[model samples]
Target: MSAHSPSELELERRAYRARQSRRSVLVAIASSIAFALVVWVTVINTSGWAGVQQAFFDPAIAWDALPRVWEGFLLNLQVLGLSVVTVAIVALLIALLRTLQGPVFLPLRALAAAYTDIFRGLPFIIVLYLVGFGLPTLADERIPVIYLGTIAVTLTYSAYVSEVIRAGIESVHPSQWLAARALGLGYGQTLRRIVLPQAFRRITPPLMNDFVAMQKDVGLISILGATDAVLAARIESAQTYNFTPYIVAGILFILLAIPTIRLTDWYTARLRRREQTGALL
Candidate 1:
């Protein structure tokens, strides 16, 4: 055989590998199906499947809950969008403040540190309660509940995001900052033009993770009865005496979360590849 051409043995080996790969995939699928079927059969036989069906699998109840839950989910998306934007902006500022150098910036740095610590230390529900119920009254009750809830989310997440942003910023080497300074760039210019871009790229995976977490935590706003999916489900369950609406809401949340989860996974994989490449270099 020519140097580039496969020999007969090589052709047979390739064919065998391809067939093995296909067979392995089929086996995996069949095994998964069989395992699930066995578990399901056990559950159905042991537990009263009829009660389970009535509680969780009622099609009519699900159908009735769908429209209201969807309407509430739209509100959830709105709040989540606003909170994410707010958190991003606030966290960036806090991170910048936290990273500031010298006595001139000490107070700001301390305040930023305190903010992150206090907020991060607080339970999520307390933040919701304080912001949703407490903050509005300070403004003579002018703020709307949805707006207040958004603020709560913003306050709670900004602490976490600020830490992530700070980590990203600090991960950029000191040499890059010095190099920018050597080019006659000011501190702000160095950060804006040289450091932040690389930092953001390096931290995309963690930031994506943070955003995914925030997506699900957005459900907490429903506790304030602002008519989010969770609240909608609760209301429906109360009316119907069936818990299927909660399941429906849970499924809706899972559906909403899937894209972010996939994106997080993709970004993490890419980050790993880049780190591996750097290690090789």
Candidate 2:
């Protein structure tokens, strides 16, 4: 069969829309340029701009610090990598415990609830200090600072991620459980095959947000004398009294976070589109 040709009015409307799109793009670019120029002019004209630039934006200092900071950043990545795995395991178990239905499970549920409440209420830095210093004193063998830091991170984030996972699990419709059971699926099978997949899909954006937050927080391990990026920056800064290394570390973290941030945004929009279109999967 021959394809039907577009009508004259349809072609004209398409051309009009194209023109509008082009105009919008141009306007956006122009406005962005203007805003940037205003910011540059305002910033440079400030009284302390020169001192601030020398202290925080020195190219030479940044270049000098980059290698050490990058090395330390690898440690941060290691902590983050281990924490992600540990958090997933611990959080999933806690979430599952919280969701279990039985009179006998009351203690488990209460413990999970208390775990979340306590950790979530405690400041992360305090937890880091407690775990970092307190753990070392109790063990006869010397424990690595990195390990202690990772444990602290795991303890803190597991509580938060468990809540997120539990919320996702609860968000699944009750009928899904009944339908899976009606098809001869066991509770575990229903959760694995039917419920968790959907819950993960629904919760992915928030999960990614949590992951990004984790990426930044992993640098906190530096406080435990683990010599991560932040400590490296501090060392470099102390040498010359220039804060530029700190800026370099900040930029590196921002660069690390950018891809995940963009991915989260893209997936969130994709999910929104799917939901709007009533996609089943």
The top-ranked prediction according to lDDT is 2
lDDT of 2 by residue, 73-152 (tens): 99999888899999999999999999999999999999999999999999999999999988988885679877998899
Best by TM-score: 2
TM-score of 1: 0.90
TM-score of candidate 2 versus the correct structure, residues matched by position: 0.94
Q: Estimate each model's TM-score.
A: 0.90, 0.94
lDDT of 2: 0.94
Worst 10 residues of 1 by lDDT: 136-145
What's the lDDT for all of these models? 0.90, 0.94
lDDT of each residue in 19-116, candidate 1, tens digit only: 99999999999999999999888887666888998999899999999999999988889988999889999999999999999999999999999999
